[model samples]
Target: MSALQIFVLALVQGITEFLPISSSAHLVLVPVLFGWADQGPLMDVAVHTGTLLAVLVYFRKDTVGLLLAALGSIGIVPARRAVAGSVYGKLFWALVIATLPVVIAGFWLSASGLHAVLRSPQIIAGTSILFGVLLWLADRYGPRVKALDAMALKPALLIGLAQILALIPGTSRAGITMTAGLALGFGRQEAARFSMLLAIPTLIAAGTLAGAEIAASEDTMLWRDALTGAGLSFLAALGAIHGLMRWLSHAGMTPFVLYRIALGLVLIIFFWTGSS
Candidate 1:
């Protein structure tokens, strides 16, 4: 893509990736709606990579504390038997449980026939509306359950399974997972934070696998282009991550839900009119 297109896409990816709005949908629709060239896989990786770095940096203190608590004291008690209620221990197990379903399901989708069908706008509109409504209902009625660390194992897995819905083109991993948390009665901030933390391992696995594929490809020019795109995406993503976390913590997801509904309705209308 051209430099301007790349910059816009990077900015869009950065802001929307962490927000409750569907980053995948924005990424997909932006190019198609505006007739821009494909942002391609490399740029896609860069955007998420940037966001990932933002999350890591923003939560570094929590991460370090968790690691220390998990590893236990240097001169003190048993490391392996470190406090189970500790932030690190809890977050560690929670992340593991939350990541399991997506790992299997996402890899399966990538390898399966569903991969071929992933480009459909109809499916995007449908899933977007469906999950968007789900998020609304969740925020409306789900319980006031414990924050991420306090959640039960089974619930975390259930939310993770919900995350698998994002494997589809427009379903949006962050949107789906946050909805799941809301459905389980998590407060907006807590649900969003855990959703982000869980994304750490999940996205790394995805990026690594995709990067490996790129590396194995024979086209050297393609690799170079992909690297440039990925770099841009990463830089933009960092800003997105910072903004989303700050905004969501204070504002909840009502605005995003409204945007999803509007976007879905417009797409559905366009698809319907195409036949008439």
Candidate 2:
């Protein structure tokens, strides 16, 4: 890919990855809309790696606490009652539970080849609109009183199930999970925060799979392009995460929901016009 294409695509991946907007839809549609060639899987892996690193770095303290708590839970370290009752231990298991459904569904869908078939603009447009409405409803009407400390087994599993919908290109892993979190009464920042933390494992798994494919392929991996994509995406994602968390404290999900709706409508119009 050209440097311009690399930069734009990486920026899109970074900004949308953690947003309520569907990154997959933008990744697919950006190339088509701009008449650029497909970015291919290696680039996808690289940009995803960047977002992974961004989230890890942004939440380094939480990551460390969770890791230590997990080790403590497994008896690898001394388990403190205080730590056990804190956000770290509860969130560690919550993420593990919330990550399970998507991992399993992703494997099944990939094996079935249904995953590829669902990548069309038509499906993306439909999902974007549908889930956008769901997000709005959850945000507007659902109780927004609970904090991350209230995260528990049932809600985490429900969010995981919602995450499975993200297997559809425009359903948006972050969007759907945040929707579930909102519906479960989590405060806006808390919901967004947990959604981002949950992305760590999901992104790592996806990057690893894509990396394996690159390793096995005969196609030349452009190290320069990959590194550029990674760095640019990391910077963009860090800003996106910070800005989003800050915004959520003052505003709600209305802005993001409207964006999703507008984007979905535009895609629908584009597809309909092209087909006609």
Candidate 3:
């Protein structure tokens, strides 16, 4: 990939990964729109790794608390009763339970090769518009009383189930999970925060799988390109995460919904015209 292609793909990944807009859709669309080749799995792994780092940095305090909370629960760190009994401890379990559905689903899809079959522009357009509407409805009508402190098993499971849809090209993991959070009456910031935290495990699962593929493949991937993409994506993702959290503090998901709908419609037109 040229520098321009690397820069554009990295920028798109960083910005859209955490938003209610579908990052996977954007990544798929951008290449087709520009007539560029697929950025390949190595690039996917790199950009995702970068965003993972951004989430870890932005939520550093929560990440540490959750880590301690997990250890406390497992009796790894003895006499940490207070941490074990706190909300973070509960949240750690909530996250674990929440991550299970998607992991199973992803593995199934990979084994069946159905994941590749679902990567077309038509699928993306349909999912983007459909889920975008869902987000709008959830944000407009769902009660916003609960915060992260209120996270529990039921809500976490519901949100995790919703995340399974994210395996579809345009059904964004962040978007669907946030929609579930809002529909469950969590506030916008709270929903976004949990969605991001949930991404930690999801990204790890994805990156690990991608890494294994790259390692086993005969094709040589350019480490230079991967590193460049990772570095640029990291900076872009950090800024995007910061911007999203600040935006949610005072606003809602309306703008992102509009963007998703518009992008979906545009992709639909592009798909039809190209097919004709």
Candidate 4:
């Protein structure tokens, strides 16, 4: 890949990974749209690693709290006295409940080989528009009475189940999860916060699986490109997270919904014209 390809792909990954927009869709479409070679699983792992780092750094306080809470639950310390453990402990368990569904679903999809089969432009266009509408509806009508700290097992589990849809390219893990959050009465920013936090484990699992695939393949892992992608994506992801959090404070998901719709329409047109 050229420097420009690396930079563009990394930027797209970093920005869309967090936004309600689908990062996978953009990554797939960008290369096809530009007539560039597919950026193999190695690069996917690399950019995902960068976004994973961005989440850890941005949510360091929550990360530390969750860590202490987990340790406390494991008897490494008194649960009551551990930093933020009293509440974060419950949150820790809630996140666990939320992560299980997708992990299982993802494994099943990969094993069935449907994961690769679902990566077409038609699927992307349909999901991008469909889920974008879901987001808009959830935002427009859903009550915003809950905060992140108030999260419970049921809601978290529901959100996790919704995340299974993210296995489909344009369904968007962040978007679907946040849509579920909104529908469940979480405030917009609160929904986004939890969505991002939830991404930590999901991304780790994804990166690990992708890394393993690369390791098993005969294809050489280009460390230089990986590092460049990771570095650029890290910076872009951090900025995206910060900007998105700030934006959600004042606005709803309307802008993102519109963008997704527009993107989907454009993709539809492109594919239709190409086929004709």
Worst 10-residue stretch by lDDT in candidate 4? 77-86
The digit string of per-residue lDDT tens for model 2 on 97-122 reads 99999889989998999977887899
lDDT of 3 by residue, 16-116 (tens): 89988888888888888899999876788788888888899999988888888877877876535657556788899899999999989989998999988
Candidate 4 has an lDDT of 0.90
Q: Which 10-residue window of candidate 3 scores lowest in summed lDDT?
A: 77-86
Residues 204-260, model 4: lDDT tens digits: 876787667656666443667877898899999999999999999888899999999
TM-score of each: 0.85, 0.94, 0.94, 0.94
Candidate 2 structure lDDT = 0.88
Error of 1 at 183 (Å): 1.6
Top model number, lDDT:
4
By lDDT, the better pick of 1 and 3 is 3
Alpha-carbon error at 84 in model 3, in Å?
A: 3.9
Model 2, residue 60: what's the lDDT?
A: 93
Cα deviation at 188, candidate 4, in Å, is 0.5
lDDT of 4 at 257: 98
The C-alpha RMSD in Å for every predicted model, in order, reads 3.4, 1.9, 1.9, 2.1
